[model samples]
Target: MSPGGKSAKSSSPSPPANYSAAGEEFIGVDDFNEDAHTPESKTGSAYLEIHSRQNNAILKKNQEESIETINYLEIQSFELLNT
Candidate 1:
């Protein structure tokens, strides 16, 4: 028996390969309506922005704290060496 359980000379038709391309256009808030005012929508948008800002601040604080800890360790090592 061959590797595929058939003779090596057995001919089999191969299927054609397929390909596709797709994309989408993003629409901003200003593109939707002229006067469809709603308080909830505005509040939600503002809340998201505030949340993003807070997250960025927390990340920055953590990074600064890490640097400070590393500096403190270096100073203590230097003091130990002098003694």
Candidate 2:
């Protein structure tokens, strides 16, 4: 109830067209418009940049893990030789 004695309308927040809440995008089947080009290009570039960063991070973590494994294996080899 509002102060003016009117019922307030309820609305759910929604993502804009072509985008999902999980950060995925969908391409429309309609014909493309010139005005839509710039925004779409920018959105695609931004999405690519984000994905590239995520991939780089994963690669870095994997490299670190590999280095740790190699160091552990080297230590084990040295211990085995001493025994």
Candidate 3:
């Protein structure tokens, strides 16, 4: 028995050394043909795309608003200094 009552033979493998050099194997036609026309899958993908676009637009708008606020503050500061 090893530490914590676990045997040495039950140890997991270490991370691959040359990970970048490995190539992924694609599944064959039989696996690919499965779920060729899934309505739920199509709907989910469309929803994801729309949600992603909306979130991106909201983020851009917030960034633009922040820049405008910063510019307004700078202009006010300049005006105050000139007075």
Which has the greatest TM-score?
Answer: 2
Q: Write the per-residue lDDT of candidate 3 for residues 1-83, one digit (tens) a residue.
A: 88999776945564333221133332232222234322235554565578789999999999999999999999999999999
* Clash count (model 2, backbone only): 0
Highest lDDT against the true fold, candidate: 2
Models sorted by TM-score, best on top: 2, 3, 1
* Residue-level lDDT tens digits of model 2 in 1-83: 98899998768666555555554665641322323432346556566678789999999999999999999999999999999
Clash count, predicted structure 3: 0
Q: List the residue pairs that clash in candidate 3.
A: none
Residue-level lDDT of model 1, residues 1-83, one tens digit each, is 77988777646543222211122322343432224322235654675578789999999999999999999999999999999
- TM-score per candidate, in order? 0.42, 0.53, 0.47
Q: Scored by Cα lDDT, where does model 1 land? A: 0.59
Worst lDDT run of 10 residues, candidate 1, spans 16-25
Lowest lDDT 10-residue stretch of candidate 2? 29-38
Candidate 1 segments exceeding 4 Å error: 1-43
Alpha-carbon lDDT, every model: 0.59, 0.68, 0.60
